[model samples]
Target chain A: MGNSKLYKGSLNTIILKLLDEEGKMYGYEITQKVKELSKGELNITEGALYPALHKLEAEGLLDVEVAKVDNRLRKYYKLTKQGEKETVNRLAELEDFIRSMQQLVNPDWSIQ
Target chain B: MAISKEEVIYIDNYLKFLGVKYMDIRLEILDHLASEFENIQEPTSLGDFLRTKRSFVKRYENQWQKAKHWAHQRALIKRIIGYFYKPNQLFIPICIGIFFGFNATLLPKSLIAISFCISLIVPQCIHFYIYYKPEGIYKNIQSAKYILSIMALPSIFMYLMGIMAPIIKESPTVFYAYWFFAMVFNIAGLQEVMTLKRQIVKTYSKLISN
Candidate 1:
């Protein structure tokens, strides 16, 4: 798995970005999507994913809908308008951090 | 392979047997379990499969409880504070203040104190009943219980004010201030209950429709 600690701080932004792309997703779907997109390198555990989701919901950054799918109730979360704006800001911040880390780790290398 | 309806019940009962009491939380976990269960190639009894996830039961409960507590507390405070700024909402509390303020001079001290205490007690009882009664929608929902606990703040205020009643009654100014504060507290509590009731109704309707 990818270094969980390294990715921990970016979890919420990852979630927002995914929701922005997919429109709406449930808990398991979010975790599975992360694992698939990262090629099984990052595992978003239940312990970490839920608290972040609940916190975002509380902050009015996300809204929820419940639907019956295949004989069970599933809750799907989507970003609010505020959440959409916040996602752009968080992604920009994450990109900057990644850029800074790349410079520190390999000063001679240039993506450009 | 997708599990049968009976298998779903088995998963639910196993969780309940392990003491996962909240229906809302359990439903979320159930979906996760079922989704993953579909991927297993080998034959496995539902109970045995659930045993592997036993460790998560406590962690999920504790994490959810803490998050729910914080979220509801913040929401309650925001909604209460909101009442003061919106003129339409502000009108109710202002009317409450006016009623208490006008009665302060006319009513006897003991009567006013008793009335205030009852105002706090009645809602405490009603909130408890509506949230926990056997058939209530909130009865098995963990998050609703957390919200109800925060809704109990007014009764706590009542208890403190009751203990200090002798001192407060001695000064009309202090008495009036306490009543003013109590009015806001009581109104906030009522509004929370109403809002919670509406949310619970909407949620259960969705759950039932499914």
Candidate 2:
């Protein structure tokens, strides 16, 4: 697990992967999920989470659904067809990058 | 975790006080805060909670607002495209085709005026008509000044296109092209407003009903 500065670039990929698994999620739920999944190591800040969600929504990769849940409007986001395709691509790309980084950082480990 | 109506209202006001002017963004932020409040030991008093959030929001101020502006712009564009491409509107492009196909050059001043009126003026008049009502359609719609700014775009585009209308001395191609562009701009802008109105009418009512 990397620091937030390192995690910043991969936030979108993490979000998309989460959505792929979870079906639909709202802002706070997403932050909590990320924290829980990372064992409280990766806290998706409120500032970072909503803005990224909004950016994704604008990209047409995500679709928004607003429902009045208990008299409060809760906006849920789900991956569109394009977003679903994007998630697979992003995850593959992330995996490739991780593999490359590991090989670079631990070349001696592999030799042993 | 049952968010009450009062909490919802408080969150809405807090976002506003937090300098969130964009209503669409506010809605998302409101829901977020409410959800977080549900998790905390006590959310009834958010004064202390806000101190921590102040820094989080500060981190996002510039980037979040920039993204929101782009999102709104993209939304307006999507609305315009949606308006221009209803299956029934295939004739619109065909009309543009005829202008070029017929080599229409020596158009009368009245024809230009009529096109300007029908395309640019009428649709905006319709926009204002719906806008002035007590129950305006689109929830995302802002003040008149902002709406005017958005509404001004197609109008300005047409004005620039029309400038070419009088300059053309030889071929009517340029003249007709100007008319075509102007007409499209007005109708497309109008259709965008109309589509928003329709969505609001259809969707907003259902929200309350449900």
Candidate 3:
């Protein structure tokens, strides 16, 4: 798991990347997916997840669908057309950050 | 394990008790809580687990109150831009501009002035409604009121220009400024009217209670 502070910065990108790969997802599904992907090392806390989802939805980068699930209404969020484009840009930007971090941490090896 | 129907009803009641209205945010909060209950590794009653999860109350409250305001402001701006792509919606605003453009010369000057004042005052009244009835209003409607207030800016400017319109009416170069301002305001008012803030609550009897 990465540092909490480090993960916070990439939260939006992580969400966009996830929605880019997976179809629409609800809030809990998203948190669980992130935990699964990171081997339970990175917990996308609810405080962080919900706010990011709302912000992204407000920014027109996400679309929302309200459906009845388990006798309750669930909000399913997916990337918008603009969001799809943003995923590419954000993923590229994150990859660049990872490469830079690798270079900084492993000075002896060529940064991939 | 799935949350039982009774637990779901209790959660709904608790959320309502905590003042979580907006159907969208309320539903999300409920879904998250239910999903969390299912994932609890330890054998714990759903109600017991939920009782300790203070975050639910805080989240549901913050989402519709503070976060909702932020999202509303952003949505207003984005929707304005989005209007461009939806020509059907764009057509109404453009039609308003065109109507005022041609009518400025034909309509009585007094009537034009009256419209300018109405445009300015209507939005002010909307702000007052939200302020007056802060409670019992849906978050969607409240934000819609705020949007009405925002879209009113052009009308405010148009009202300000009413004084200047007559002075420049004779000049060919600047005569259209009044009409332009009027059109901008009219378009804004047209948008706000859709929010139904002005209509008496009695009139919208079919409207679902927020």
Listing every candidate in turn, what is its Cα RMSD in Å to the true structure after a full C-alpha superposition?
A: 2.6, 4.5, 5.7
* Model 2 chain B lowest lDDT segment of ten: B141-150
Off by over 4 Å in 2: A108-112, B1-5, B13-26, B41-44, B54-90, B99-110, B113-118, B132-134, B137-153, B159-171, B206-210
How much is A34 displaced in model 1, in angstroms?
Answer: 0.6
| DockQ of model 2 vs. true complex | 0.61
Could you say which candidate leads in TM-score?
1
Q: Give model 2 RMSD, 1 decimal.
A: 4.5
lDDT over C-alpha atoms for residue B29 of model 3: 79
Candidate models: Cα lDDT each? 0.80, 0.69, 0.68
The sequence of per-residue lDDT tens digits that candidate 3 reaches over residues B75-190 is: 44555565567776677557766766765777787786676566556655655555456573434333344444445455555456657756666684465555455445445444
Docking class of 2: medium
TM-score of each: 0.88, 0.76, 0.74
Model 1 residue B97 CA deviation in Å: 2.8
Q: Provide the TM-score of chain B versus the true chain B for each model in turn.
A: 0.84, 0.63, 0.56
Record all residue pairs in model 2 with backbone atoms less than 3 Å apart, i.e. clashing. Answer: B105-B172
Q: lDDT by residue for model 1 over B1-210, one digit each (tens)?
A: 667888888888888998998788888889888877877889987778888888877688887777766676676677778878987788877787777876676888778767767766776777777777888667667767765766766666777875877978688777777766666766677677777678877876776455
